[model samples]
Target chain A: MINNQFLVFVKKEFAHVLRDRKTLLVLFGLPVMQILIFGFALTNEVKNASIVVLDQAKDHQSQRLIGRIGASRYFDIEGAVDDEEAIEQNLRSGKVKMALVIPSGFSYDLAHRNKAGLRIIADASDPNTANTLSNYLSSIIMDEQAELNANVPVPYTIIPEMRMLYNPQLKGVHNFVPGVMALVLMLVCVMMTAISIVREKETGTMEILLVSPFKPLLVILSKAVPYLLLSLVNVGTILLLSVFVLDLPVNGSILLLLAESTMFIITCLSIGLFISVKAQSQQTAMLISLMGMMLPTILFSGFMFPIENMPKPLQAITNIVPSRWYYIIVKSIMIKGLGFQAIWKETAILAGMAVFLTLVSLKNFKIRLE
Target chain B: METVIKTHELTKRYGDFIAANAISLEVYKGEIFGFLGANGAGKTTAMRMLCGLSTPSSGSAEIAGYDIYRQTEQVKKNIGYMSQKFSLYEDLTVMENIRFFGGIYGLGSKDIRLKGQALIKQLGLESEEKKLVGSLPLGWKQKLAFSVAILHSPKIVFLDEPTGGVDPLTRRQFWDLIYEAADRGITIFVTTHYMDEAEYCGRLSIMVDGNVKALDTPSALKEQYHATSMDDVFYELARGAKRSE
Candidate 1:
């Protein structure tokens, strides 16, 4: 026989969520907004970065090299600094990202000895930008050298052929799609469920629900059902956008991906349920979920940072974060095209978390209406 | 005169604070029993225990032929609770709220629809039945809340200050609903701070600082204390009460 009370409770919860405009906005708006922003505004590709040049020689070759570097779209010659202190000041003041120091070398060096040296000082506070800046500058100088030696033959030249696997374009969107999915799922499933349950407590409806014929576990299950469905819909929206708009393909079994997503969503919902049980007010529930879950999910989940590069203690802590395993599972399945065999460990971890959280929340759910 | 509710020294304590001290009382079926108390007088604590919402620290009680401690599920199924805070989902429409409460009580769809329609007509909310409950006036919401609480025809309905924060006219109309439910043999166990509403109960029990200071019919309580009204009787009993909270 069907549970009449469960159906009623679920319907009420659905109505509450659907009718709330703010919740509806967050449920649908946040995922799409995050994807679009990550895709367009937050790309790593540097363009027209301002740099200062200090040419001590001021010779034809030095001027030529500076002109060549400035001609490229990646570098813009902000000014010609005459002194090293001026270049340092410009870099320190954030007026320029890099400073090119052309040494006082005679043109006879490059023309006769076939080698000349230049120095590039970059602000390494933002390591990624510094690295990118150095790489771009080296490529430009090397391009000029290749042109000069076009007619000459090198006896032993080792050309390294590099190929980027999976994401050949190296689009930042591909890097962020899986991470965004994990963050958004955790937000919708964990944070929203927590606030919703605590809201009932704040409004005194939790007491009424406990007093009903429905068991507390069943009540929790009913609250989670709609969010589960909604999170699945969020998954669909993210996937459709990632595939069609962002061009990130799902190479592994689509069914396996969805199954893992469902498991992760359950884990997050259980976490939210546990938070609701511990918190007495909606504000407290929200604070706990956001601080305890969202921050950890974003930081330790390997969403933005590589978990391996982190310190040993931090890496061990990430082992318990559900988002870390979920990110690994989705990335392997979606980007690496790895099947269940390759991701069984992560899947098992997520499932274990789900079961543990469910048990804890069930134990915390008191039937006493207080 | 069957006893629908019977309690013996029902106590609830948190740490050293006694929210509901060792108190005992009873009420017959179909009797409108007024559980009167000042703020934090343990009337709500006692009612919460009876409605199976809270467990007693010690002693025992039987509600509608079921033990409050062991047969909590049965007790829940037999009784209806209307908290003073207005326990209906404000986001839901009037009809949806009615149907939800009705369905939880295991009523069939046809019964929910029929009873829901009848309630809508009786409350003169035919036009507003589809309207969201939050948009309605407070008085109308109170009446609808009470109706929903008794929709399942439980053996006893616990209303904790159901008429709180409403005007006098609305409260009068709300009392009519309580009297109607009591006339249909549903035991009305109500708690209120309004002394005038206490007079409407068939028998009144005034609690002072976790103890039932006086228990008798309204007229008998007044006569016993040589007071003019329930207001005076309440004042005389609560004058010397020592708060434990």
Candidate 2:
């Protein structure tokens, strides 16, 4: 059985957390917001993007090219403006996400079998969408060229029986729901735990807790329990939102989801504890957590981009990011409907990360307060 | 009185700087010992060592008869500490704070509830048991901190400038609590800058720049310096500190 001090310590932690609303917001509210933002806002699927056209060639070839480009739903010609000046003005003003200028092309040249060139400009400000839209435009052009090459009344049509697997129908929200849950939970759990401990230090509450007839680990543990529960609640909220609000799929068992989430919660709490040890004030703790944990989690945890496509150094660093494994676990279990048998490896990795971080932090704590 | 705490040539150094150098002293059971120092005088360092938060550099101290280095867990069980900051959870209700600290000391839930209720009554905080500690006045928090520090009736209590930031009337009330605990056979080794509070100590030690300049009763210290009050004595000693440099 755990020592009675540990129980009381956890109880005190619960009491402390309940009395602080900002802590609740950090642990629960922030996670929910992150889930919503990641799920809804950070989608990869291309949508109605504003575009402009400078059709220098008013010929059939130019019209056909514009028709071919605008025919796809990805680009909507927001304006039909004159000359390169208008195109540049519209593009620079951010009125159009993409712009097409068929530069003085004559249908007579295409009829003479010469190359017909079309200039495509897109708002590459959002690099991901710009790249995706560029790819989609290129593929559409390639498909039309191939159709012309095959030249039959019923040319060969390509039908892809594509299944998006975990995120069928390829909804960006599917990917985001899991990513946001992981990212938010990590930020909330780690940031809150670190800042809470730092607050005690800044306010001189830590010395009282330390000098009491309680073990130091008990004090740290007490600080952890409140956030642990809060993170779980956030997980539940994200799950509900994914199901009810976003209509996202949760094909896996939720108990399994909760189990992995608990591991992540503990993992993040240890991260916060470790951060607190390095910081002397709440402000320092907050900055450290924000810069150290939050940024890295978002960038490397496959939240916005595929980790496999990233550079080799990032791949190496991803091994150290606990949220990377957590995102994998959430995606696998929630989206892929993987059972414990399939996800046990990821779960073990998370457990190992949590145990390792918690132990290392506790060791530092033991040595420092010695 | 038997020795409740003993240190043999205990030294604590921060890098090359000697914070507490070969400091050796003993506190008999129930003695109200005062440790005096200016800011950064190593008084806090020495206190931290005695309370098991810092390890002495090369020597040894025994807390509640347990070796400071080897038996810290046992030492922790028998001692209570209160810093100038009072160290109580301000956001929690008075009773919840009591139960929380009590629980961490391994007290059963029922015992914590029963004793917490009694403690609230004793502190004349019965009406505000449900009130958050943060909302309470500074003086009340100081008293509550001291009471909670020794709620488990530890053999020794260490007060690190426990009366700081409180009014004169409340400082006196806090001393009454310290004296009462000392009278009950609890060793009271305290650190403070407030000279008037030092006079209340049965035996006092003045440290300057990590060295103990004087270790004696307040009366003896006043007599030695030919000063009228503990404040005058401390000022003379502290001013003497500048001249020695």
| Candidate 2 per-residue C-alpha lDDT over A34-107 given as tens digits, one digit per residue, 9 for 90 to 100 | 66666566545676778777777787656766677677887776868888677668867866766666656345
lDDT of model number 2:
0.78
TM (chain A), candidate 2: 0.64
lDDT of 2 by residue, B85-122 (tens): 75888878898888877877777788888888878888
**Residue A107 in model 1: lDDT:** 53
User: What would the TM-score be for candidate 1 when compared with the true structure?
Assistant: 0.80
The regions of model 1 sitting more than 4 angstroms off are A42-174, A367-370
Worst 10 residues of 2 chain A by lDDT: A158-167
Q: Clashing pairs in model 2? A: none
RMSD of each: 9.5, 10.4
Candidate 1 lDDT score at position A159: 24
* Poorest lDDT segment (10 consecutive residues) of candidate 1 chain A: A155-164
